[model samples]
Target: MTIPPGPYSPNPAPLLARALRALRRDTGLPVAFGGPVSRDGRGFVIEQLDGARTTSLLRLRVQAGAGLGGRALALARPWVVDDYFAAEEITHVYDHAVAPEHLRSIAAAPVVVDGAPRAVLYVASRSSVDFGDRLLESVARVVQLVERDLAVEEEGRRRLAAAPPALHSAEVHELVAELSQIAATVQDEGIRRRLVDVCRRTRLLAGRVPSADRSPAPAVAAVRLSPREREVLAEVARGCTNDEVAEALGLLPNTVKSYLKSAMRKLGATNRVQAVNLARAAGALD
Candidate 1:
């Protein structure tokens, strides 16, 4: 789900940093570094560096088709160099940075999401080391996680862009309800989860929308729903059955029923519809 060029640009820094940490911990790699591709898609800057002794690799920019990472980006695959300085297969444009880092063996894994390269992850060693297929596969697995997370984040952004500016409007509520139903039918679990998250956020946005004509409802201000309760109620507001809510939230049906009953009790509602309406009026589902 690609979105048109806009002021909002996707920043994969947090995801990249988290994945790199996991990679280093799981693989025991000495050095790991990478960054998200530039908005223009020309190149990426090294924004994350783990276990790196020198700051040389940090903030270093790599162009497409220029270095090991660049080759990975261009080819849309993983690449490894046993000897960084002697690798003839890749163009050595960042030799200055690599030399100071004392990194000999380096592997680059490109994280491509939705047909676009979102970021590149690199694991390197001080001494020349031959990276095996197993090691490369491990890197690939981490890259796939990053790709999946980016896809989910991108979908959330796309839905947000498609949502009306005035989320408190009746039309927006109807739209979010329809989207929630559509999310249930999607086969991709990651995408479906993101769509459901988008619906929750849309309802929250509605509660936060400013209006001069509106006054805060006292009932909304007094009721407090726990985070889990809010989550279950948000799904219920979308008209999901207890079974459907359990499936969407990875909770048991009994747990879902318990949460609904608790929320209904707090809101003085006799049924699911009334509970949702009361929650909305109270700003609990807003």
Candidate 2:
């Protein structure tokens, strides 16, 4: 198959911002921000500058292998500089960005998705301080969360890109959807990963078929049921009580109830029975 040549569709900006915020919250860092690499995958552009007093660092671009951020991205690991101006490992490519923000110390952690550096997360301080191992460890945890989410998003895109020559049938779509729900509750990591790959490819196959031949609405149709809501509703359709749904889905009972309520609201039904009826009517369920 001829893979298309272009940037991956997953937007790392929102996730990057989230990871930065989590980093700051966890490590008590005064400033935290980062951005995705350029579309060609060569440079870093600071799109999500959080905890900044001034907008001086917003949209700051750093070339690959240039600044501290660039080096982190280029080498695919975390890099720390005790003093931003006096750091010898990196050039002053982003000095203009650093000084106006009064950042004296910083560390950059690269979030890698699919073996490539996708974003560089930075935590900084206005005063000179050491970016030590404990902070780095905390940052690593945030990076893991970010990378997990990015991998999920990329798997979604690959579903679209991997669509087969023929569009998929409704039965095929239904099978894949059910399999995904089953996979969600699995315990083994390797098995879960394989199931995810299977689900992605199955979706890719299911999407290529003529729309008319598919199961109910697209997973996210106009009267969209969120994936979680859909999962809960699917169980409810089988006469599962809220507690039962919660146990099956590995969710809190209150959380299951919340998903049920949300699903009911979205389907414009006053009760679970009515909601299931509406879902079936809309082809959102089998």
TM-score of every candidate: 0.67, 0.65
Query: Across residues 1-286, which tens digit of lDDT does each residue of candidate 2 receive?
Result: 1112232455555556667788889989889988877656688778887899888888788888989999988888899998889989999978987888888889998888778777788999888776567877898888887877667556654654555556546555554555454445543344355555665566456557666766564333469778898888878765567888989999999999888889888877777766764675466776
Which portions of model 2 miss their true places by more than 4 Å?
Answer: 1-8, 165-286
Q: lDDT of each model, Cα atoms only?
A: 0.76, 0.73
Task: After superposing candidate 1 on the true structure, give the runs of residues whose Cα lies further than 4 Å from its correct spot.
Answer: 1-8, 166-201, 204-286
Give lDDT tens digits, candidate 1, residues 74-141.
89888899999998999987999988888999999888887878788999889877688777777878
Best by lDDT: 1
